[model samples]
Target chain A: MGIEFQNVNKTYPDGTVAVDQFSLHVPSHTSTVLLGSSGCGKTTLLRMVNRMVDPSSGAVLIDDEDVAGVEPVALRRRIGYVMQNSGLLPHRRVIDNIATVSRLNGVAKAAAHRRAHELMETVGLDSALAQRYPGQLSGGQQQRVGVARGLAADPNILLMDEPFGAVDPLVRLELQRELTRIQSELHKTIIFVTHDIDEALTLGDQIVVLKKGGEVAQIGTPQQIVESPADDFVAQFLGLDSARRTLSAAPRDDGGWFVSDAQGRPLGVVDSLPQHPGQNA
Target chain B: MAWILDHLPRILELSLAHLLLAAPAIAAAFLVAVPIAWAANRVRPLREIVVSGTGLLYAVPSLPLFIVLPIILGTGVRDTLNVIVALTIFGLALMVRSAADALDSVDGGVRLASTAVGYSAALRFFTVELPLAGPALLAGLRVVSVSTISLVSVSAVLGVQSLGSLFTDGFERGIVPSIVAGIAFTAVLALLLDLLLVAAGRLTMPWVKGGRR
Candidate 1:
């Protein structure tokens, strides 16, 4: 299901405006990433969908239905939420953790466990790990269980708040790939929150680059944002002006061309040139 | 040693009486403290009031509490019921605070996750929060158990019959062995109760065993 945020505003009692006048349309069956650094209110915007944080003003709607009309608990049960640090219960075994929402929804014990075993496999976790507590698993394995638990309820919308932020880069890459594969098979409307530009680029079909107070710096495909940033803040946040993002190509002795960063660090080699050089011209 | 052998049956009787007094108070304190601790955990102002207010109950001298409870409860000073009630009050004083701290030790992330996964507040408390707080709660109960066992001896000052009578009689008769024996048996009882708590913790909280994490 698609989600819409209409002029949402969130202000803390202490007078901090966490989100202000934010509006967006998250298309169904697509991954929409809200990308920004900390304190940018990206997470606050994502949480508004499930009513984890009710807006101080404006409304959040799911499939043209205003979420305010729905009970928060009922609304949340149908929305899958995955957070950073895995957040798996320390005292619960992996199977029970995965079966948590299913059981809460009143699925019988044997059926819930059966579905939990299936979800474990869906998330690429070994069935052998099902009986172990979350503490006994590795960080990546625990995150796999977190993903499994998120998918256990089989909700239409999945909210991920930096779901892979705590793992090592290699594990994060693997998890990202796994999520992409899962999204391909199951086209849930996914609202992903992250600070990493590369992660947003890799996973998001539509990326919403946010500024402080959840201000929209840019909203476009990753290519559009990379090729033309909306403003200096978007450019700087994406490191477009930095050497890390700027690449230089040098002709290699072989037929391939060597691509390197501005600092002469090798990025990779392009095997073949465009069929027609300067085709735009 | 000779006196203990001669009065072995008497010592056994007193020990049984002592167990009877301590066990019910300890159990009642635990049952009472859990709900109060849960209430205290829910609100900030209430936490301060409940924890500190109950804590003051410990400062009421046991002999006076034993003596005063008769008038309040309409029981005689020497009634076993009066001592048990007094000890329950004392146990609550320690237990309420420990239970609150135990609940506080549960991970905030886990609590949030539990709610996000659709657990109702009451179900979350019983299933997730309470079980997660088990180890610390068990630790607190161990302290309350040992202290309650030792504190039962204080009832003897009110003319109630318990193993503590051995101390009073030994002092009157100038028999050091009787006093030493009473102390030994009290320590041994505390040790046995502590071990039982540990065993119960092991049985119920399997996740805490096997050096996991």
Candidate 2:
């Protein structure tokens, strides 16, 4: 089910404001990315769903029920959360790690492990690795196991906080695609928090572009945000200087400079815009 | 070496006593220190203070602690329990801090992930935090075990028959063989215990063998 935040605010005891009067809705069965720079409180906002961080004021609701009213441990068991560096338990074998939530909820060991083995294939990992410890896996493999663990319990809401931030660029891209494929089939409500705008554009169905102090600078689909920035701040944050980008229909003979990707496949159409002070479109 | 061979049977008896004295103390200490360390880790403000307080206890001369324990615990002066209690105090002193330090050594990322994955506080401690803390905790136990083995001889000064009696009997009668045998056996015992702990650590934490293949 979808999650809704109503005027949530978080102020640490040391007087630093992390999130201030923030509100957003994460629609069900879609990836809604919370995108911003550091100190934007995106992680804090994400953690509030699992009650890892309690908001100072207002309510976070899941399917019309206030999250604050649910027991935190129970709430967390029903939600899946992932973070950067694949946070797998070092002491646990891959299957055991994936089956952690199931085992915690009292699933029999053999049955839980069977589910974990199935999840391995679902996450594109070899079943042979099930008995191996997390320390024996590569970074990409570890991230896959982390995602599998998140999915093992079959939760409807999955919260990923920069889960691929530590992997190589090629591995990161592969994982991003993996996630998209998984989401297409699973249709879980996903709240993805990330600092990279490129990742936000690639993954988010609706990108919540947050500003400092946890304010929403803009929120739109990737295409909408790229086509029409809400303000100079939004444009600047996206590195969209007037000179670098345009939607013009110029040079129709060449189809306005068809943009080819690394493998020379047509990726997008681009047209130059008026120049910015630093560069040109 | 010759003295040890000549008194092999007596040597074996004292060694057994020493083993009984040290092993139970270290085991008791490990059980008690783990919870203390876990508690201390949670109370950040008191973590260093608690660690320091325990460290101070470790420094209290073992001989005095062993000698005075009958007064405090109301046991017979020669009771082996006194030595066990004294060494346990020392073990806790050293190990509480070691356990805390080991727990602290765990990766913050992993610890946070453990919580995020719906692990109850207690479950996380056993399944994630404690296992991850294994290498350092084993290292601490290594130190505690070796020291406890060596300290068992000190109890002989309080009329408890142990390896330390070799030193006493040898010194009083001006007999060098007993002193020599005690020194040799104690060193051998300490080495054996250290190796056992190391083997146990390797067995329990096979993942720490090396980097990922």
Best by TM-score: 1
Could you tell me which 10 consecutive residues in candidate 2 chain B have the lowest summed lDDT? B204-213
Q: Return the lDDT, model 2, position B4.
A: 73
Best candidate according to DockQ? 2
Scored against the true structure, residue B27 in model 1 reaches a CA lDDT of 93
Local error of candidate 2 at residue B211 (angstroms): 3.8
Model 1: lDDT of residue A45: 90
Off by over 4 Å in 2: A242-281
Clashes of 2: 3
Measured as a fraction from 0 to 1, the native contacts recovered by model 1 come to: 0.57
TM-score of chain B of 2: 0.96
- The per-residue C-alpha lDDT of model 1 at residue A242 equals 93
- Return the TM-score for candidate 2, rounded to 2 decimals: 0.92
TM-scores, all models, native as reference:
0.97, 0.92
The list of candidate 1 runs beyond 4 A from truth reads A275-281, B210-213
